[model samples]
Target: MPARTQLSALRTFRPSKRLKVSAVALTAAGATTALALAGTATQSTSALPAIDVAKVTAGSQAGTKVEGLTQGVADKAYPAYVGKPTAAAAKNTSRDLTKAPAKAKPAAAAEHKAKPAANRSTVRKPVAVSAPKYADNLDGWIRESLAIMKAKGIPGSYSGLHRNIIRESSGNPNAVNDWDINAINGIPSKGLLQVIQPTFDTYHVAGTANHLTDPVANITAAANYAAHRYGSIDNVNSAY
Candidate 1:
């Protein structure tokens, strides 16, 4: 390998203009070119395009004779040098907001005020729950899905919907490849249980792109997919 990088080597290179002198100035630059060819050299005003300059540099920097050498740069090893590193990328400004936001919430305040034994109420909201559709494990799937739905801004409850994802991916975070009936073109399904690439792309939310592999994006996309296919995940436990 010849110093490969993510970008092409030629595109990054820029030849120094140290030799931009006229033919007359070059002759005056003189003895620097002496002890070699005696041929007179003339200058042309037309500047070669970058690609042309690169090609010429690619040739000459190899120590090939401009007049008749056939050696290409690839024939020899060229010692590589690296410039000093530029300033480090500014420190990421990401903040841990979970704690302060929780403390500031009205629900937290209400909970604190109602903690006294006399103020506690025996009445509880009727929480509707359902069984998992997929038959196996059910732990963590609903809570994760609820968090996903909120992150996506999708308004719905995991109430009767947990069964849907339980059926789709069984809570495997990076699941792909569906050997069952879902495998297409031989690659397994992927992310937050399983979602085929095309379907994910079709249902992906605006801010959540690359849903096929990104967990959050996939979760959001899966929620949207379920909502789009069935009236809700509660109806058809399709993709999840």
Candidate 2:
């Protein structure tokens, strides 16, 4: 062969050093991305929707990880597959009341929550009508109220039984009745219960101060009325 032909046949080719660095850099980046995706896949799936682990492991063994490489992309790829609410739900939120949610009626619900209600039947005034009241002394009217409870056949639940006595006269003999309920006859209702003339006339004896003004007698009459109507002196709660 001629010298020029021989020299042309022998060619020297050397790849640039950067090509080796580029391959190493690319391999490192791919490895890092793989590590990150692996970590994300293993993260606490406690709140996540259920995924079949056996199928994932089978796919991984079958080189499915390389096939699913791009699927691990965070916001765009993973979330696109998930179906979440496009907009927030504010219809039932408290900041806006227009939703008119089904709930307990406001007035009734508030009343129930407030604890102490205006069940006046059970409300007792803190102070005795005037003061200086001794439980043992309990006054003639209180005694009569008890007697009336006995006559009526009511149970003597002290809290309930005394509730009426407290209402009528606060367990005081000096307590007067000046209530507005009229008796229709000449005598205005007076004394502990404001008993009228007709009621007093029916129950009162001629001589004893059992007239409408007498506290003990009036209380006793009221007790009798309660006993006759409700059938128990202790049935004080029913008096109201």
Candidate 3:
């Protein structure tokens, strides 16, 4: 047989085998192209040609005829060629999901809780104070009486009260005038200032003990009487 005649005979009988071989070769080429494109996925897609996965997959499956595959068919066949995510992108997403949120400091939270409110009102308890102490003598009594007299608005001096007290009772708080005219009538004059019970009761200052012989009470009442009768005890030098 001639070589040309033998080749024609092979072409007629083994057409299906040739078609299958060509389809397989085309599928492998397309896959290689896809892999090369995937290696440079991070680069500009504007410069790269769009792949036709539909035609490749159709050629592989039919082995009889190959045609342009639709977008839907291409998506099902080669997902990597249609916006497939990279490993770095997937890793970044996983890192973001696993990251922990920032927490508030314990010390700052405690300090905020411990702080006092600005609008809160506070109350204070009253303190008790005792009266001032004085010595147990004539001078002490006079000084104490002067303080009381000043508070009561009665006018008298220390020298005037002291002088009258000495002249009347010789500084004796328990002095009495039993032989006087007032004593004859049963109302005897008594105390440091020789004040009778009626006179003492009439001019007795409040807050003092209501006893004629009580030095402070006696002085205060007598001074008060002297202030009324002669303007002040300082104005009276002798018996009036």
User: Quick one: best TM-score, which candidate?
Assistant: 3
Model 1 worst lDDT window (10 residues) = 35-44
Candidate 2 residues 42-101, lDDT tens each?
Answer: 343332444445544444445444224422322233353333224454343536667677
lDDT of 3 by residue, 43-146 (tens): 33333334555654554445423334454555555555445447888787776676688777999989998997675365657688989998878899999999
Residue 67's lDDT in candidate 3: 39
The better candidate by TM-score, 1 or 2, is 1
> What tens-digit string does per-residue lDDT give for candidate 1 at 1-240?
132431253243332354333323556656445211122221121232122334445555555533233334322222121121234422332455454653457888899888866635667788989843432234444455556577666655665455655565666666666575657566567865477778787887775456476655666676777777665555664443
Give the least accurate 10-residue stretch of model 2, judged by summed lDDT.
6-15
Q: Give lDDT: candidate 1, residue 101.
A: 50
On lDDT, the candidate that comes out on top is 3
lDDT-sorted candidate list, best first:
3, 1, 2
Candidate 2 — which residues are off by over 4 angstroms?
A: 1-140, 144-161, 169-187, 205-208, 236-240
lDDT of each: 0.52, 0.51, 0.76
Please provide TM-scores, in order, for all candidate models, with all chains considered together: 0.34, 0.31, 0.54
Candidate 3 least-lDDT 10 residues: 38-47
> Looking at model 1, how many pairs of residues clash?
4
Cα error, candidate 2, residue 225 (Å): 1.1
